[model samples]
Target: MQDKSFSPERQSAFDARFEAQKIAFGPIVFQCVRYAWKRGMLQALAEAGDTGLSVDELAATGRWTPYVLKVVLETCLSAGVVQLRAGRYQLDKTGYCVLSDTITQINLDFVHDVCYVGMHDLDRSLDAGKPLGLQALGPWPTLYEGLSSLPEPAKTSWFAFDHFYSDTSFPAILRDVFSSGARQLMDIGANTGKFSRAALAHDAQVQLHLVDLPQQLAVADITLREAGVRERAHLHPVDMLDPAAPFPAGMDVVWMSQFLSCFSEPVIASILQRAAKALAHDGQVLIMDTFWDRQRYDIAAYCLINTSPYFTAMASGNSKVYESTDYIRLCEEAGLRLVSARDDIGYCHSLLRFAKA
Candidate 1:
C-alpha cells in the first residue's frame, strides 16, 4: 500500500476542529477512558446492549455517585468512546475495543504504569543525553539494567508490554531461524530465555547458547531448567556495552530479537561486529525488530514512532525504534552484509539477515 499522508484541503473545517480538539485533550481523554474501563463503566455499558443504561442505572449498578459517573462519561462521549441517546449510555466501536482488545489494554497499562511519569523527563533526557526519567523507577542508568528489579506495577507492565509484541512472532521466527539446520545457535539478550526454550522445543537436536546480563541470565536459568532444556542450554553473562568483551565464538546462527533497539548506533555497531567475529564461516546473524519506517500500515508506524520517547526517557537514552536503512548501514560498518530483508512477519516486525563480509 502507498504511504498515508494528511491533507487538510481534503477535510472539512469541522474535521480540522475535531482533530485539533482531540490533540489538545488527548491526555485527559486517555485517563478518562482508562478510568471508565477500570471502574466497570464500559463493561456495564457494553452489557446494557441496544437499549443501553441511563446514568442513574449505571451509578446504582456500580455504586458510584451520578456526579462522578457523569464527569467521566462526558469525557468518554467527547472522545467517541461512548454515545448517549434518550438519557442512555452505550458503548461505541472505540469503547468496545478499549474494553476487549488485548493490544489496547497492554498499551494502556504500559503507558500508565511505566512510561507516563517517566515521560516528564523527556526534555531533560534529551538535553543531558541520558535516561534521566529512569530515576522515577530506580537508580539504574537504563531500563534494561533494572528490568529484573523494577517495582510493583511498573515491573508487571514492562514485561507484559515487552513480551506481548515479540511472543506472537516466535512460531514463524523459530522456523526461519532453524531453516538452515543450525545446530549451535546463540541468542543474544536472551531475556528470560523464552526464545531459547522455544528453539529447544522446536528441535531437540539444537544446542542453545544464551548471552545476557548476569541478572537477566538468572531469570533465564530458572525458566530453562523448568522447561527441561537446561541440559542443552548454556548461559554466558556479559555486559554488552563493554566494547572489550567478545561474544562466544563459532556459532551457526546469532539471533537477536527485539534486542538491538536497546542501544545507540555505535553500541549496535559494536555488538554487530562482535557477532560477525563469533559467526562460523557459513553462519548468519538474524535481527528481528519493529522498524517503524518498514511497517505496512500507518497505525503500526505511528505506534513505533511514539515508542521512541520511551527509549529516551526510560530505556537507554541513546537508542530508539530505528529505520531499516539505519540497521543496514550499521551492518555495513560492522563488516557484515545484509543478505536479506523480510517485512510483515508477525504483527509489525521486520527481520534483517546478515552474514560476515
Candidate 2:
C-alpha cells in the first residue's frame, strides 16, 4: 500500500472539493469588495492633488454623474478612502497614491475607465474565451489601449497602481534573485523603469536596458535621467510581443514582472522562446506572475472572478491567469529549465527562475 502522504488519490480529492467551494461563495464577497474598491478610488481621486471636490463638484467636473458620485462617495467614505473632515472629503495616503497622480491607471482608471466597461461582458468573455470588455472597446481588443485614450490626470494617475504593487516585493526578491551580482540586465515591458532603478541602485556595476512603448520610453527617459542613472540606461521603444522588434543578444538577466499574464498562451510561448534565445549561456530569466492556489479557495476565486476579468479586458481580451505548472511547461518548451520556484512575496504572485538548458 502506498503511503497516504504520497497518494495522488488523496490530493486530487481534496483539491477538487476545495475548488468547488471557492467558485460558489467567493463571487459574493469579491463583488462586494470590488464595488467598495472602485468607489473608494474615485472618491480619493476627487479629493487628492490639492484639487478637492465635493460630491456636487465631482459630479460636475469629474466623469461620474452627481447621483452616482453621491452614492460612490458614501461607499468610499465607509471604506476609508476618504475622511469626513467637517463634512468635507479628503484623500487618505493609500487613497492618494492609488487614486491621484501617485501611481498607474490600474486602480483609478482601471476600475471606472476600463474594468467597468469590460465587466459588462464578463459573461461573454467567459463564453467566448475572450473578454467581452475588450471586444466592446475596439476591433483588436486591448485594455491598455483603451485606457491609453484617456486624457491627462487620469492617464498619469493610472501609473500608481502598477508602481506601488510591484515595489511590495522588491529588495527581498531582488536580493534573492541577484545575489550573485549581475552585470547587464534587460527589463522587458519596463514601465517607468522603476525596477531598473532598483537593480541599478542595488548594484552600481549593472547596466540597464529599459524597453517599452515609445510613449512610455519618453516618460522613462525623464525618470531615469532624474534618478541620475540615465547614463547607464538605454531605452528601447517597441511592443514586447512583436517578433520583428530588435533586442540586444546575450544579457546577464531578463526580467518580466506582472506582464506575462496579459498575453495568450501562443504569444507568451513566443516571448519565452525569444527571451531564452536572448539569454547568455549563464544568463537567467525571472518571471513574476499570479498563480492558482489549492489551499486558499477564497483567494483562487478572487483571482479568477475579480482579478482576471480586468486583466483579460486590459490585455486586448487575450490575457488570463495561468497555473504554475502551465507556466513551467512554457519555459520548458522554450528550452529553459526551471531553476527555482517560490511564492515568497505576494500571496497571488509566483516568482519563477529559469536558465537556458
Stretches off by above 4 angstroms in model 2 are: 1-110, 123-141, 146-158, 294-297
C-alpha lDDT score of every prediction, in listed order:
0.91, 0.66
Among all candidates shown, the one with the greatest TM-score: 1
lDDT of 1 at 105: 97
Candidate 1 global lDDT: 0.91
* All candidates: TM-score: 0.96, 0.67
State, as a TM-score between 0 and 1, how close model 1 is to the true structure.
Answer: 0.96
113 Cα displacement, candidate 1 (Å)? 0.5
- Clash count per candidate: 0, 12
Candidate 2: TM-score? 0.67
Q: Provide the lDDT at 290 for model 1.
A: 99
Over 4 Å off in model 1, which ranges?
A: 1-9, 12-14
* Per-residue lDDT of model 1, residues 195-225, tens digit only: 9999999998998999999999999999999
lDDT (Cα, tens digit) per residue for candidate 2, span 11-105: 67777786667567544433443454555544545536455656665666666676766665665565455666655666665455445443223
